[model samples]
Target: MVETVASLSGNESFDVVVIGAGGAGMSAALFAAIDGARVLLVESTEYVGGTTAYSAGTTWIPASMHMASVNRDDSQATAEAFLNRAVGARSSAAMRRAFLDAGPKAVAHIEANSDVKYRARPFHPDYLSELEGSTLCGRALEPLPFDDRKLGRAFALIRAPIPEFTVLGGMMIDRDDIGHLLNMTKSLASFKHAAKLLARHARDRIGSPRGTRLVMGNALIGRLLYSLMQRGVTVLTRTTVEALHTGKRGVEGLTLAQGGERRRVSVTGGVILASGGFNRHAARRADMLPGADAAWCPGAPGHTGNAQDLALAAGARFGEGALSHAFWAPVSVRKRADGTTAVFPHFLMDRGKPGMIVVDASGRRFLNENTSYHLFGIAMQEAHRTRASVPAYLVTDSEGIRKYGLGMVRPGGKGLQPFIDDGYLTQASTLDELAAKLGIDKTGLADSVARMNRYAETGVDPDFQRGTTDYQRANGDANWTGPNPCLGPIAQAPFYAVRLYPGDIGAATGLVTDTNARVLNRDDQPIGGLYACGNDMQSVMGGVYPGPGITLGPGLAFAYLAGRHAAARAASPEAGHADAREETRAQTS
Candidate 1:
């Protein structure tokens, strides 16, 4: 029942207007509608899901109802303690508290009122498991698989997953699906599961462009979209906001343009900015993240800081004191058949696996290879200051490559010639040969390899302690019957390597907002009828990537807060004025 508009030629009115059709925007629109407010969801792109669709869809919400299903010992107090140790003073305590308190409520409300549902991941560990009060599981939730066949022709409206992430010409798979597909020939149950998936995908290809079996972030987006459609929300895609119409009270309306036609839209509740972030903004990137290359970034393209610019012009200031201006990950680049560059983020797939070692230009190990992708990226940047680590080499021998794969190279090592032909992957028969081809110190490379071999034999990486942490161990091959799951000798011939660059995944510094998710002015006063969430709002983690789905977790929670606050404002207009003044006094004081 969703109204998809092509041209905006008439003056319209809505209670809540949400910019960007990402997870945050969709959640905000849904929450507002649930509160009896007429909602409008807008997107600059043709599809609904943003960078989220390209992700693994791990939502980190502590102490939710699903937690006890996995780990009954998980408590809000324990989660808070973990945050205190991991995040500390990098972000505001109030914002963190607000997220913790509202997260479960948001999850519960959405599940109760809509098609969206989540279950706790059985063994998803916190990235920083070494930190105090960290639990092995129960915090991160996974979206259940959704049938896109229910969407019919509307299936195309959902954004497709990354090309490299899919298999069999766009058949999307999840963690569970991956295991089954890999073991299909060996196990009967896995074969049945994989057979069913392949059968469904084959049937879907007959009519649709891709598979109708949705999982991960696409499932989350599809569920949200379906829920919004059921509620009759108006969605306008490929539309750009030209201007904001504001009065003394605050943002009241927006000037939108679609297909060269302009229309004025009034909003009685508020405008919520969830337009990703400033990662794609050239000016912002130059100002905030110097020396970072956009070619390395794998985020969605619609996040160009357009909404943030409007808020800044209205006196909204960016948050300060973040450890880094943006979140980052180490990515390998390759040119696809479509002539577009594919920047693949190396997160938890091959880096932490045995027989892998990343080396700098001097052919020296500069970091713990098993560390989180965010820390790995930061280390690359930090190492670049002294040595040439911008394009670090991820070296793995033939055995390793065959077992774990490198970058875009799929496991089982069937289609490696294409990767090598495109110069995306470097292959050499010997360690010294690889060093020579990569223009690195041959002696340094040999020494590093020897040291790694010894460490592998002893099952202790004394240099960087690769397998010391629980997270690292979990990321390794559990089937390995060795002293250390994350350690293995790189003695095989025909080494493979892929170049890695630091990629800014999302912005951490963005428009400042209160605990209620209302955008604030330069003087710390709430801008009535205005709000921000997702990457458009400054990260509550203060630029730290604590665990999987950190971005989506806070994004959904704050979107709920903003939606409820805006709906209440719509119910009582006078309360908006009083709440604004009270918030101003409280923040300024």
Candidate 2:
């Protein structure tokens, strides 16, 4: 679907020019186009779908009307209360109300406009289950099932999640459903799944592929984009937004680059920059989050805050230390440089997959073993104050090796054992030898080990108190008998260690936006024709991951708002909302 090229002398115009063809951008484009706005979506990659394409592909909305239809107690008031509590008292009053008021409408509009169907996950809770205002269901909603063929030739334009998160996902499965798949392997219904998969493979052999569909985040975007394309939104991949130009009132146009060429477009409606945050930019990371010394982001390489810079140029106010980092489970993988390093989050989240440890510079326990990804990063920040590079250990037993398949690439050999054989990992027959190998006070190591053993025996940690919280205990091993879930102690023989620290998925800091997504400028004025969403701006949830699809949820909402507003402007330029302002300072630092 290539469009004919045309040269522009003064300015190029469209109803909306959306930067970053990821979830939010794509969502906005679809809505804008539907609103009868001439929409143009620009992307840096050869294909659309940003880091979200690498995600499990679910959209989570709590107290959703969809879930309530399935027999749950979800009302608009309850939804507002949940978001208000999630944001606490640190948010713009107008923005918070706007998010609550407009969230459901956004969901409904997208559901009706896109090829995707919305489904409420069976039972997903907002993080912190014990909280008073939390709801057990109806708050989280995800994209329903979809077929990849709907995209027609544009199927390849979409990317699927990495196998780990997407193997069972259909671009729309709820995050909790991931844990369920491991449980569903024997849920009797597996017999039908096996047959369907076999049938699809057989059809592939005959060249009559039909129902081998795209699901989860991919499915969600595929369906959304399918509808968007049908409505005539032009998604320009491998294209970049070079500059944002203002008119008499506010933003009026943008300069774009593609294939070593640049083009300027006039946007009568506006420009929405949802290009995502700069998680991989070390310089930006060091400056925005001074405590986040080490980051192992799982986001797209192109996520370098280009949109944030553009928003800043237009005078958008930023949130308070709206940290832009993700919590990784800490897994060891071979880096592109052929060096071995740990990928946080994935390692810690899936206990059955692999196991690792975390220690301080002196090879001592600094935080609870099983902590929230956000909290763990904070601990890492605190530890970095004493040294240029803090030393930590990931001690594991031989069983941890065989059961979880723990391994990391080394110069000569692979896995942590070589590190033990070499001097990289401290190895010891007794806890004393292991502590000696770690170069710490042996007594302290032995004492730590003994304390851990006691906790494992009773399933109740005394010190730092691991597995004590409702949410923190969710990741604990099932076989453990103590009051804590992930607690079983580290008393096994032939202990192993690997160096580690706080490595986040990405940063959370971004531009301060009203609930309706109208970016407020430094002077507390609306930029008239501009908007920003996704990681390029401050997270709606302020970097605290509450439940599944946190980023996707609000990102999708603001996106819908941006598109709705853009389309409305395209229809009538004077119909803009008047009061989206700069009081969003409490959102980030």
Candidate 3:
């Protein structure tokens, strides 16, 4: 069942070869193939979709067609303002210009030609209080609906990573919807919502049409892949491109591997390396982020940046600061039933706990643990440099566990069993045992407890002055009638301890490229026939998770551009090498 073409000596190679079949790679391959040029897509894993399948599946494409129809209008000027504000000065002028210009067009292209559907709902807000151009809902385009059966074998590759996660019509549910769902308990409409989800699951079970099984990220990519297959794009899964065949000047093609056999494939058109980053590589993580040696990634396990190494071997110079990383949030973890692992999102779990106080290695309270993953991860990183180890503690009392949601095995419940059993949670009749187990000074913890108790009695936190905003207190429990939402005295018998470590959604540092997804050399020159996307490439948000699907949006867009541009050259024999040697040599010299 495996086809191996040993050499491209006399054989006709594909007009385009996309290295990686994630959302970005798939989009690029499909775009190129449908445009009439022969295409080949190589994926490291036996399956296609990458980190995207595990995501919420929302795409942040501002000024998209969906937005325009819903009256969420924006001009080049508005888009520019937003990018400049979010990225500040990290992104180049040319890079910013290319992203803004092509962003909407990318959205339009998928909507018009692809099997995708979208609706406008703009109530989501940016993480930052000061962020602008971050519209709540409409600006973020979500997939309308998808039927799983249409995917066939490809459906097996798609991830059902999140279970028991009820959603409606591709709508991302936040705290508001949770409240609404709860309030509608006896209402007929509530039953309808419940019925739809149940029917969707039931239908998916019986292989009877998957109409109602429409989730977000999977749904979006599912529709995109369906459109791609219809375009005659042959997705060669379980294949890996090991090397980029570059000449003295630019990349020529790629050497592909399938089932332990190697073959040379011509990229006469070009090659796009959207193969992803090295998050799963322990060595890389430890090297990039100190103390990351102990950390684990929540990103897809398939990403190893194989294409990154291949590009460098081909003499591709890396962009300046190419090693910069993002998305390293400190997290608490426990073993799953499968003996694998499950990392709980810290922000979601930490904010709602009662009598819980997060401290640094110095047993000192630092930044709020309730911040977004990236922000908290950064704080943890910065904290590591000063303290003996990662500085973070979640001190919760019995009442807090009973009241606030700790994200245990059950939803909205205290997660005490795992922590206590794993020695991370230390319960002591006296605070000293808890402090000893946590490796903290008992007096320091006692002092912290005293201040917390005073704050609880006075109904106001004086130490950190917590809960200055609704966002901060939104995750706190209302059971404690206090000026402070989550604050309570940890003076109860049996204190608990959990070891804190920095965790990441994935390694954000990746190969640097241009707007067209072309890999850039040290001098900022494009290495023709080479490109990268997804986590393998530096993020467009300058390391910030601007919103949901922030990483995947540009990942799809640039991969589409990379594939098309390469295919254009492949389809036309007259695309003679426009010598950039002089320019490149001069710059390198």
Report how far residue 248 has shifted in candidate 3, in Å.
8.8
Ranking by TM-score: 1, 3, 2
Each prediction's TM-score versus the true structure:
0.97, 0.82, 0.83
lDDT of 3 by residue, 5-60 (tens): 44334444777877776777777887777677777777777666776766666676
lDDT of each: 0.89, 0.63, 0.63
**Model 1 has how many clashing residue pairs?**
0
Question: What is candidate 2's lDDT per residue for 483-586, written digit by digit as tens?
Answer: 55666556567766665545555446777766657677775556678887777657766666656676787777788888888778767755543322222232
Candidate 1: tens digits of C-alpha lDDT, residues 443-484: 988999999999988999989989898998999888777789
Candidate 1 lDDT: 0.89
| Candidates in descending lDDT order | 1, 3, 2
* Model 2 spans with C-alpha error above 4 angstroms: 2-12, 69-71, 74-76, 82-86, 163-215, 280-283, 291-295, 321-333, 336-344, 351-357, 386-392, 401-445, 478-483, 491-499, 576-589
Best by lDDT: 1
